[model samples]
Target chain A: MYQTIGEEIQVAGLFKKGRFWPSKFKWSGQTFNIQKITLTAEANNGGVKLRYYSVLASGNLYRLQYNRQFETWRLMEIWCEG
Target chain B: MKGEVGLTGLNHCLSDYKDCWAHVDINSYFATLIQQENPALRGQPVGIVKESGRTCIIAASKEAKLLGVSTGSRKDEALLLAPNIRLIPAQFDFYLDATRRLKRLFESLSPEVQIFSLDEAFINLTSCKYLYRDTHTFGTLVQTKIKQELGEWVTANVGISWNRFLAKIAGETGPKGSITSINQENLDYKLATTKFTDVSGVGYRLEKRLKAIGIENLYQIKLFSNQELEKHLGPFWSKQLRKMSFGEEPNLFEHIDSNPHMKSVGRSITGYKLCNNETEIKQILYNLVLETASKARSMGLAGRQISVYLSGEGRYWFSHVTLPSYVNQNKEVFELVYHYLYKKWQRSFLVIKFGVRLSLLKPETQINQPLWPTWHKQRYLEKAVDELAQKYGLFTVRPASLLNGQLIRPEVTGFLGDKSFQLGS
Candidate 1:
């Protein structure tokens, strides 16, 4: 199942080789430790570029979106596996 | 005499069946993508609309389809049918991204993949047959790879056949998430039962004509001679139909070129809002001309004939103009459109859709210098503008009139081809 949660979150990651790699993020009183990056795609929202990451954390997949113009992060989706 | 063989000859041809092409068609493409994006929406009554709670449904999920809500259904009607139905606005960028990922998967299997649409592709697996023992094995591999790589929700129905047309039919008629093959053995039986209209090229007009001549099924098409079919349908169409009916590859299909020259290129825009005035119509026409011209220019081709069409409230109007020289510039095409609109300027009905078509195309390298001095200057200026637009982006440079106009931004498009994501955007 996937849930839509458009909530701003604090992301702690390193910017290596001009790309942001998220190591972890705190969202809704819970911390998700990133394990691997599955897919990365870019989208343009109202002329502002946003980088979306489909990452695997704790054996579950989550969609994290980072706004380039606003310099903020938001948790977009969570794919929970049973 | 040998080429004129009938049922017996067709049966003999079955012994030489060879799997060459595989058509992969995504199920309920846009709706499936929406469901895949949000698993919560899966197996639910979902209708994808251009706008939430406003526009008609552009695509309906299988759940909504089961409830008799389909594309072009009004939002009110959909709500009445299924009150709990979810209407999601279309996200074209995400759909295009999924298409790209699917294309990559197809490429991993075969190098000769032709994207028929954003959700369908024809891959020639003739050269890669040695890698897999049979077509069924190869088809299974494709389905498994897509599910594992893209998503388990992203399923496809694949059809394997000797030609593109048969493969397409098999894909459409086959069970969802399964592989079906239409070879020479079952070609005659399939054609006997399949209606002529079910075939791709046979539209309503053609179906009516075929029915008038007592041609109802695909088998009837095989009985007609090429000359007889030509008299009924046009020469080119008759030849294609004959080839398809006989299970013989057309010349174009046999010698499939990587980049074939297009006979015509066109695009149509159907907006949710209505255009009630001439100025508004012209603004939309200008935007369409820009798109058509950009597409032609991108293909390194120029057209000598331009056609403009406007439709609203069951009324349709069209005008065609022929230019002295081949041109692929927005200003030139817009001038032709303006001339037509000036003569037929009637704000009677609210315009819902407008389109522009460019035909009689020739290679851009064959263009000759115009005699008029102003045209010469205009050509150079347009060339520089096109170069900048290609490099930076289409919206980087635009006409001053479009600055205030509420025109939709044109995306990267191909002539008679699928919409692809622009690189470096």
Candidate 2:
């Protein structure tokens, strides 16, 4: 099941190959270790360019958004596997 | 006929900016998007449903399609066919965002781009076609660009042709990663082999109608007189078929269209279960009204005609009427529909599906400014609400009556009926 969780989160990753690769994220007082970055896309959020990474962490899916203008990270949404 | 068409088509294409157009179609759109997001689902049979607990599979991944679990199959049937298949809910917002970025990339590559749908677009490469050497090379470069910029696993097919019709036909015929082209030289041969239904806009119903009249081949349609085809297929389609046969764009995207207007703004929903409750029905109707009106307002459009439709197990209800004044506000459109349309449907009808459409569209400016200051205040309030909705979400602020019920999510239509609404946003 998937649920909307649009909250600012702390994220750590490497900016490699001209793109950011998020490897870990902290949301709702819990840490999720990223397993793989399955898909990526960039979109304009109210004139701010934000790159999105749909990552798999602990067998669950999370959409990690990084705002380029503000230099902030947000956990946009999540899909949990039962 | 070929000689005449070749000469005229050459001249038309030479001067048309849409000359050497390329149709870019994402492969197995929804399924692939899901697979691209989840690592465990990659290389596995995947089916995308509208949401959890929904049974019908709207899309199937390449693996699932290869396994014979067809689209529109029940979840149970899909399990039987591919037991290990994963089912994911449709993520229309994600799809739209990705599509927007893809369109931006296409726009960067070409001067003119037409956003056809969430998964497809037509790129005009006439001015820059020479830069990539040939159509095939250009297509390959686009595929590479998609992989490099979008995602490594996500891929798209490129179809190049002289016109929109031929380009779309070429795009739909090839394999997921293949680059196909149709031009004047191969146009006749392609038409001879392509099925009537395979051509865009020719659905099964039209195919059955054509078959009823013994017209089997797309190329052979030219052999029949216009009167004979019109007698059976109606004049609009008869003309359309002739245009398709010649690979001519019938309308709209012939020029570089950035702000194409919509003929209508509509929203419809099919519930997961049959709903017989009046309150639930009203909520659904309200949701539909809110969406259609919001779309109209955002585009600075208003409609004088409102159509409401509903379907039960054995009955269908429809109402279409014109209002004295054009309306683009959600509350105004909702009141008209609720009073004239929904209220008339029998309470016990057991609605399985419902829809509302706002047509006879004109610019909001077409309506005269009302004499009341309250009306102007209401319009300003609505504009503020719309701006907030655009920034946050569609349902960021909604009626209290919809507080308990599940909010119906507004999706970007796959056919792109409202081009400016989806593409501009």
Candidate 3:
């Protein structure tokens, strides 16, 4: 199942090879460690360009968005296996 | 018809390609991305539909394909083929984003690259071929970099040749994750072994046409003159076939990339379920107008001709009108479509699908006009609304009419028409 959850969250990551690699994130009073980043892409909402990282953790997929202009992180969506 | 042939201008026979181009085709792009994101789906049959309850599959996993569940297969047919096939909604944004990343990697490898579609790209290796020992070395470099930068599960086939035509064919010939190269030395052999249908432009009907003319392979076209081919095919195809017979990339084939000016901007949708209410149907039409107009506006294009289509319940309503002036804003296009399309439908039962198109487009930059007071006021109002949309989100502020029913969220098409709007939305 897929869920659209646009909630602001806290993310911790490492800067490697001139790119920010998100290692973990906190959402909904729980912490999920990112096992791997499957893909990263930049999208523009109106004029605000944001970067999204698709990460796998805890047997689920998370789409995390980062707006560089505001220095904020938003949890965009999640895919959970049933 | 002359200029319509496409870029690199004139057509002539060219010599063999010595590692001049590389075509990278991401195998089962949408399905692979899904598998990459969710490991549980890696070994299973997967079908990607537009949304829940949507019957048609836009893409299928290699497993599903092997089971005869190809793209365009209905959900019912897919289940018949693979009972346990997992049907997932397509994540267009994710797929597009992945393509962008791949494009960046290709651009880094070579200064010139052609993104044919979401899953395919052609990189001009002419300038950089001197740095590599052979096409295999360069192909391996591309594969290794892809695994390192994208993900281990993401894989592609690489084809290297002198031009885009043969390179793409070579990529298609190889198994997944393999590199295939064709040159003058093996050109005839490759053409002899490959079916005409394997070529990009050749479809089932065209293949039948070729076979009807006693032509079975690409090499046979060379044996016949363009005049003889023209007797079977048209003037255009005869010329195109002559070039393709010699492993030449036809300029006409690159029309989309060569022509930046779009002829039309349109939007179509198949609703979750059929609706019969007049108000509900009108809401959908208005929604489509918003999408079409916004796309044209984003592309800085305005159209003088507008067309609309509605089909369902054993009835069809199609209409088109040439406006007094070109229009690109939502207000103008919506008002016109409402008058020319929706209001004109004498009767309605149910609407399963509908579409709106703006054609005869011209660049907004080319339109120079003296501003009238009313027009100036409307333009300012539109500018204000666009600012709000851009600052907040595309649908953050919508017309009050859209609130009458459930609003349809914006969706992008697989064929990346009006890319500015697709990528932005």
Candidate 4:
């Protein structure tokens, strides 16, 4: 239900000492629960790799690709399923 | 085939026996008037409305008629048929003033003047034979006067015939901005081909009925025996229908009424972003009341019923209130509307247009003076304000409360109450 035509963003707890610094978290003086996310493929070419898996937002379309070796994702070459 | 040709010109001894009559019908009078006033509207499908609403089209130009749009057609229906049709609101007061001014021009040409409506009229040129050498010369003079006094944009189709019906038909079929006639010659040919509905007496509904009965042409209806027509259409209607078919005259006396009265006084303003504030709304109401009341005073009459209408932005939330007592006072009308506005509208920002109407009125003398001090004082204050406004001008003096920013003022709401509204006795 959280899926959109472009970018999908997510945040989760990473600390184990009963405390953790939230990355890419929107703070409104309150905590929010994470939900399932999905993104649409780029308009053309192969999926671009990202340091963190993130989908292309708007304007020129590009897909999200992840690198298993670096434990990160980056938008690499432009790719589209269609 | 038995049409008379040049009889009037040849037989001067029996000119009185002939008694030539003529009518000048303005093609699409209201729409054409607007087009003549604004050149941009020329050659477009124009529809005029008595009030801006979904309900009715008061008049339509020739261009509009071709699209199956007509007078009294619902605006929504007209729009569906011709989306690009131009819509114009009826300015009765403007037309009335122009009618009066044009009548003066007609009076100069002929002693007998009969105003058919705000847009059309007939002048009896029978008594004024000495004014011009021929009927054509006289028509040209009348045409010149109208063009000179009223704008050149306005045109009339002049019909010089023996009687009113033939003249009316002549004017209806004539070319734009010129004089034409249905004379002894070609009368049958004109009537034969013309649609029954296009004739003045037979409307669309009757035309449809006539066609269903295998009477598609006016000539066929004319050929039917009186007893045969009477058997199908009954006595009174058959008589009238037979007149239309035979090119005979109808009962013109019953049709013509002389005294014209203003039915209602109203004012509307556009371009006010729909407003939610109470004070601003009241100011618009006040201005409308002031204008209406002043018109009442000018016409020597007062309104007993006051109507207030507010249209929400883009055709949502439309409501109207009609008050019972005739009021020509601004304060009285505004106070009534104030209560309605306060009750219905939340202080939300969404009002685009507003209007006030005073109707079901009698003469100013008929304004009842109640024994209550508040009512009497309010009435007096209103009378004073209306008087002052007439002498000086609108907004020359107004309540301080009405100066608030929430009030909507439209560009068309020129200081002159000369066009948008008028009071009727």
- What's the TM-score of every candidate structure? 0.75, 0.86, 0.89, 0.55
lDDT digits (tens) for residues B1-425 of candidate 3 = 01111211111112234448889998888888888877778879999999877889999998898899998999999999999899888877778777778778998998887777778888988877776656666777898988776678888888888888998888887777877777766688778778876798887888899999899988899999877899899998888878888899876457636656778998888887777787777788888898788778778889999998888888878999997778887887888888766788876567898899999999988886437787778777777877787787776778888876766666666656655444332
The DockQ score of candidate 1 comes to 0.16
| iRMSD value for model 2 | 4.2
* Residue-wise C-alpha lDDT for candidate 3, range A1-82, written one tens digit per residue: 6678999999999999898899999998999999978777777766667898888888688989998757899998888666
State the C-alpha lDDT per candidate: 0.73, 0.79, 0.80, 0.58
Model 1 agreement with the true structure over B301-324: per-residue lDDT tens digits: 899999888788889788788878
Give the TM-score (vs. native) of candidate 4. Answer: 0.55
lDDT (C-alpha) at residue B386 in model 1: 76
**What DockQ does each prediction reach against the true complex?**
0.16, 0.36, 0.61, 0.01
As for candidate 3, its clashing pairs are B17-B162
Residue B18 in model 1: lDDT? 60
- Judged by DockQ cut-offs, the docking class of candidate 4 is incorrect
- What candidate 3 gets wrong by more than 4 Å, as runs, is A3-8, A15-19, A67-76, B1-19, B223-227, B313-316, B347-349, B419-425
Q: Which ten residues in a row have the lowest lDDT in candidate 1 chain B?
A: B1-10
lDDT of 4 by residue, B1-425 (tens): 12222322111211431566667666676776666654456688889875444346878987898899988787789999888887776544345555657667777777776666556667776776555555456556667777776566667777666677776776666556556556555678778867665577677777777776789877788678888888877797788877777777776534454334456767776532557766666666776666666666566566666666666755544445555556666666666666654357554446657777777767666566567888778767766765564454455567787665543322222122333221111
Candidate 2 residue-wise lDDT, A1-82, digit = tens:
5677889999988989786788898988999999888777666543356688888888788988887876889888888665
At residue B201, candidate 1 shows an lDDT of 65
Arranged by lDDT, best first: 3, 2, 1, 4
Which ranges in model 1 have alpha carbons more than 4 Å from their true place? A1-82, B1-19, B51-54, B193-198, B208-216, B219-246, B249-259, B339-343, B371-393, B411-425
Query: iRMS of each prediction in angstroms?
Result: 6.4, 4.2, 1.8, 32.7
Ranking by TM-score: 3, 2, 1, 4
Off by over 4 Å in 2: A1-9, A13-21, A27-30, A41-52, A58-60, A65-82, B1-18, B250-260, B387-396
lDDT of 3: 0.80
